[model samples]
Target: MSLLLQIETATTSCSVALAKDGVVLGFKQINQRNIHAEVITLFVEELLVSAGLKYDELDAIAVSSGPGSYTGLRIGISTAKGLCFALDKPLIAIETLEAMVYGIINADQSAISADTLLCPMIDARRMEVFTAVFSAGGTKIKPTAAEIIDANSFADLLEINKILFFGDGAEKCREVLGAHRNASFLPDFVNSAVHLTQKALEKFRNKEFEDVAYFEPYYLKDFIAGKKAV
Candidate 1:
């Protein structure tokens, strides 16, 4: 029986889950903005207590490594690393976009056909998002990229494929891509720690652990500090 702790703060959601043998045991999450730093550790503690498992009992600690928020990823990775170091446990890093796709498929597998594609997006800013494309079977078709939404975006693929666009970034994109017959949007599909269960379990079975001391979240872009108002 593999016991794991999962953390996901990749977007505005601060979520934590305890899973044993790929089954979610307990979960706690809040989707308000700017609460990651405040609630992540508390949520972890609560879940551990609720699940009746000690930190050292965990087989591995899984975190959603991001192509999403810079600060959110930092908080989640730092917390996971801290726990891993303290308990001498291996660390598992789940790709943020892949996890989001898993959450979607897990929720409604019937809606996705073999030819349908999954495009998970994370809001970067106005009209821009971090996204990637995956097949219904979870094979990555397009690598993660920062894309500027426009009427012409994904035009070629939409012509040939039925693409399901989701995540926080998908809402803004609906208007821009709505006219395309093959472009479909799944609104309100936020990233969650529950989604990390299966992927983390696979990594644990394959012994795909990261170096606890050096592992960092995949911040696809460099942080740019905002200028002070004069």
Candidate 2:
């Protein structure tokens, strides 16, 4: 059956899903910042129960390896690694931006042939993002980058066709990117584990599983914790 368990906590949302052979059997998600640590395990348990499965039954665990929230990524990676160790299973890390794109790409029947570009962005901080652009066929047009806001950053990238930018960061940067006539935004898009099902299945078949002992989330920048100035 090739059962896979997937987790995504790369942004404000915390999502988990149970799938068999690339088809989701059950899923749960909550879109609130700072809740990944609080809700991830509960959601995982819920999905397992809904799918009538157990931790030991999963063939592998797949997680969104991030260029998104630093704390959120840590919470997810730690939980996933713990399960991997306990269950004696392989772990798969999918890029956060790529997962976001997958969520958008598979959302509709029209998406398969849409000639527009898909640029998925994650809010890294004020005026910054972890983002990349992909063609309708899922080929990367612009490699993921930790970019600062600018009017012309994507000017050249949009010359070919329109782009659909969506994520936590997309709305914030829409105006700045609006100088390019071909650019548009899709604010409804959010990260989800359902998107990782097929991707994880592909990795599982190709033996691209990851070693859990040393695996870590891809926080695009160093995390810095601070308090308000007194």
Candidate 3:
């Protein structure tokens, strides 16, 4: 009977979902840059109204703890934290890439072979991405890290395994990894809050909650601020 409010602002998607017992009741989202700060709260309120739940009724708030955009993560985590504090509900965090793995697998797309591997990438800068590798069953076979994609990237794995490269960062890799018969790319893939349900539910059941007072997003790489305009 857990009611969870999920938010994902990682990458360019600003999404919100309200779920009951791990099932998405209602959700809304937009894939646009620099709009998270404007629409995240609106999305949450709309979901609450559509789902017939109030802030106080949420059992917990789940947010994507990211290896994604620094600003996007900040907006998402701050919004989730604000609700948790106002409602006195617990906060749960799911890794951005992990939820993404859940997203693609849950899509039930055409047969993913037993030998196929799952990898979700979040755009960083030119040629670099925040990424990880997962088994077909969604187990993390490789740790999350910031990788610079090149012809040799994942060479060993690509030799024997079919790897699916996806997310906002994957499109850029096609030129580098395309010739490999073992590597394939998923186009137009965007992260969504809906994917946070299963893991959030598991964390709620296990009482795995973050300290509301001191939680922070997993920025993966150090954020370097741009130079000030002269």
Candidate 4:
């Protein structure tokens, strides 16, 4: 049985999960601002202990490589890389948005129609968001991009397919896209490490691992530092 440790700190959430054969065995998570650095390692230690597993027994470490928070991504990836280096285990990188979509599908499979589109959004500030579109079956239809939301943002796609929008960015988008006939939103959906299990297992089975020393989070846009008030 393959044992994997998954970490997701892409947003305000700091989540960790231990999985065996694509199923979660233990999970610990918290949604708090700027606590990723403090809790990520603790959560990992707690999950392993709770599951009665040792770090050496882990097959690989899976991290949510992101298009989300810059600091959060850096903290998560650095932790995952350190674990891989110390344990001599491979690293599995799961796309943040893809995992979010997977979580949505797993949460309520029956509610999604074959033609329904999945739009996973990570708030990028103001009216812009990091987003991508996926088919109900988990196929990527639109590549990830930082988009400025507006009334006509997804109008063309909405004309042909019903789109399900969720995640932090969706909350602000509802006021703009809510009036559309085919637009549906699930504001309660949140990202978690548990959602990384299936993808991590698949990558492990396929021998797909990131270079421990060189791998980095997928920060889709360049980080722009804000100016401090004098």
Candidate 5:
């Protein structure tokens, strides 16, 4: 059994899941910002107990390395790295936006047959988002961005077919990008531990693991700390 523990704290969601062979066995999650640090470990404990497994039994650990909240990503990656060190397991670092796209593709394989593109967006504040373009085949047509999307952020991609937009940041792009004839919205898509777990397992088998000590969240943009007058 390829038992993997997955963690996703890229946005407001705090999630942890346990999976074996790409099948989710247990998951726990919350959609509140600023709680990942406090709740993630607890959720992990709960998930393990629920799955009738021990922490030492995990074969590997996976974490959503981000294009989302700066603080959230730090907390998640730190925790994941710590666990990997303590448990002596490989660390699978999955991209935050890419993981969201995988969730969409896994959810509906049929959506792509009609030429629908999956665009996963994570809010980056002040009208910006951490986003990327993914084709139905799970290829990254566009790399992740820290873009202040407007009427033409993805004009080229939108021209091909209707794009399915989701994640916490998706709704905010409506007034700007939603006017396009080829833009569509899926309101309830949020990152989940279950999706993270499955994606991690696949990555592990493909030797996609990263160095635990050096792995860091993909905070697409530089985290600009606010300055105060001296």
Candidate 6:
């Protein structure tokens, strides 16, 4: 049986999960900003204890590789990498937006249709988002990109296909795209480590592991630190 420890801090949610054979055993997460560093490892430790598994017992460590928060991504990827090195386990990296697509599918399968497109967004600077489009079946329909939203954003796609816009970045887009008849939103979606399970399992079976010493978070855009008031 394959056992994986998944970590996700690519957004406000700081989450961790343990999965056995592609099924999520359990997860712990808190959807509040700026607390990832303090709680991530603690969450991981608690999870393994709860599941009665040791760090070495884990077949792999999976982390959400992101187009999300710069700080959050660093915290998550660094933690996963540290564990991989220490435990001598292979690391699996899953795209943040892709895992999110699975999250909504698992939660709201009945509401989605084969024709509807899924767009997962991670908030970036004012009006911009790290986003991508996917089919409900989890196929990537569009490559991930950092986009500035406007009334015309996704206008062409909305004309033919219905879309479900969600994640931390969806709210800012509501006023811009929500007016369209074909557009819908999943109001309370939050990133979770459990979302990484499905893809992690796939990558594990395929032996798609990353070079532990060289892997880095996909920050989509360069990070700019804010200067404090003088």
| Model number with the top lDDT | 4
C-alpha RMSD between model 6 and the true structure: 0.8
The lDDT, on a scale of 0 to 1, for candidate 2 is: 0.86
TM-score against truth, every candidate: 0.98, 0.95, 0.97, 0.98, 0.94, 0.98
Whole-model Cα lDDT per candidate? 0.93, 0.86, 0.93, 0.94, 0.86, 0.93
Which ten contiguous residues of candidate 2 have the minimum total lDDT? 105-114
**Candidate 6 residue runs with Cα over 4 Å from true position:** none
lDDT of 1 by residue, 1-230 (tens): 79999999999999999999999999999998899999999998998888777887899999999989999999999999999989899999999999999998888899899999999999998999999999998889899999999999988899999999999999999998988999999877878999999999999999999998888889898988789999
| Candidate 6 per-residue C-alpha lDDT over 107-153 given as tens digits, one digit per residue, 9 for 90 to 100 | 77989999999999999989999999999798997899999999999
How close to the true structure is residue 124 of candidate 3, measured as C-alpha lDDT? 98
Error of 4 at 180 (Å): 0.4
- Candidate 5 yields a Cα-based lDDT of 0.86
- Cα displacement (angstroms), candidate 3, residue 176, comes to 0.4
Report the C-alpha lDDT of model 5 over 1-230, residue by residue, as the tens digit: 69999999988999998889888888899999799999999999999998888999999999989888899999989989999999999999888888888888788787666477888889878788888888877788888877888887888878877788889899999988888898988898888867675578778899888988787888877889888989
TM-score of 5: 0.94
Which stretches in model 3 have alpha-carbon errors above 4 Å?
228-230
Return the clash pairs for model 3, or none.
Answer: none
- Candidate 6: worst-modelled 10 consecutive residues by lDDT: 48-57
Q: Which ranges of candidate 1 are over 4 A from the true structure? A: 228-230
Error of 6 at 123 (Å): 0.4
